[model samples]
Target: MHAGSWHNRYPGESRIVLDLTSLISLYDTALAPSLVLVCAGLERCDHRVLGISSEDISRLMRKLTEVVSRPDWVGSGIDQKTLIHVIVDRYVDRLELMQHLLNFTSSDSQELLQRAKLAQAQLRVMLTPYLLHSTVVPSSDTSGVDAPHWASLMFKNCATMHTSVMINQILLMTSSEHL
Candidate 1:
């Protein structure tokens, strides 16, 4: 149910767990940092009811994983190979965190997993710049280009092509990674 609808049904309910996918999908960066905090908090809740095994933690981990799609990747002016490395490193970190979370036997395993997932999400975002700079990219001076577009466009020769090849390799590895 929607928040208003849910409120209508249980105005004085003691517990309410939200599914934030729809809201986060509409995000501008302005909301991301705050939403990440809210989502992180809700993810730490204990929402068991009527004897059902709570899946909030599992649900949250999956949603946070999905919520990481940043449109900034499309035209951030970073070379493509650099983008590829960043994405792969991010995914690898995600996988490692997920793996660690999967091994827990704590009484609060779900909460722990939720926390770990959030940590990973934040880490991935923070590490993006480092990943982009991980490769030693050759710099091409745009001394002649007067326009910003032309100047920005000149990072397209070796830096761009190499990035494309690197990105393709990362995609191939990611695809076959599950096989």
Candidate 2:
């Protein structure tokens, strides 16, 4: 599928119609996995093989930012703590995909990497409130969900992924210096 088509299909202001299952399905079936495959193919073959362009990457990033920024999951009548798992999973996949593109793509590599970093930072800012809320000790009125434990696990996963990406970036820079 063309990246432009994916961008066009993204939910807009009417995204309130999207339930959690639908949103998760969209991410699993169309968005992140497709991008990962594209990145993998780009690594193995030329862009022509997958019909992807630098422009496609930029547009996809914008669409992804829009998707992530919108709070479609807010009113979905599910436990917010459970949704954090999905959110973390999505962001981690996005970060890993960005790392692959940063390391593998030859065209506009630095520009795309900068864009990815900015996006990742923005996501972290967005997630901070939720993380803080989750880690707080719950009162008797709240469900006994052990939110702090889940939040800690999710935070650790995100930190580990970030550290790996940074290590990869440093290695790439050092190896390029030798070349």
Candidate 3:
């Protein structure tokens, strides 16, 4: 498979899948469908889909679960339920997905894991009111009525806003440091 070609189309998905593959190769087990659900959710937010096959998602999820289920994960304060929440929550944007996945794979620091967990919880809490006040459909058009597309738009907005905030903070810190 030409992973690079797919990468050009899907951006971060290739790396995410590769990372998951390497982790799962060490263990010989079948992958799960829930993992694909998580990846699909993230892909929907990014507005990029390279026609990911069911097999690919299954393998990726298998590796993901294996990596997260390690004994040290619990000690780090990120458990299965937290992972599920992140995966199933359609409101979770690509940045949040990337951040959580990075933490799942490379977070040796408990502080970082805790922070990631907190961020996910905060996002969920923020969505609760919207979910309650609005209908099942998200209101995205001029009509101000709810539609399904609203969720994806909201996810993109959240990711964009988070990225802008981070960039601004970095710039501020850089200027202050120079001073």
| Top-scoring candidate (TM-score) | 3
| Superposed model 2: Cα runs more than 4 Å off | 1-106, 133-179
Q: Which stretches in model 1 have alpha-carbon errors above 4 Å?
A: 1-28, 32-34, 44-90, 93-154, 157-164, 167-179
Cα lDDT tens digits for candidate 1, 47-106: 222222235444545666665653332344444343544656647866676556565566
Best by lDDT: 2
Steric overlap count per candidate: 2, 0, 4
lDDT of 2 by residue, 1-179 (tens): 47556654323334334344434322232334444455554443343325445555565677668768876465646444334544565478766765664554446768877877876776686566345444456575887688777667768866565455556767999999999
Superposed Cα RMSD, model 3: 17.7
* 2 versus 3: better TM-score goes to: 3
Residue runs of model 3 more than 4 Å from their true location after superposition? 1-149
> lDDT value for candidate 3?
0.52
In order, the Cα lDDT scores of the candidates are 0.51, 0.56, 0.52
Q: After superposition, how far is residue 20 of candidate 1 from its true place, in Å?
A: 20
As for model 1, its CA RMSD to the true structure in angstroms is 16.1
Assess the local accuracy of residue 145 in candidate 3 as a C-alpha lDDT between 0 and 100. 53
Which wins on lDDT, candidate 1 or candidate 3?
3
| Residue 94 accuracy (lDDT) in model 1 | 67
Error of 2 at 7 (Å): 21
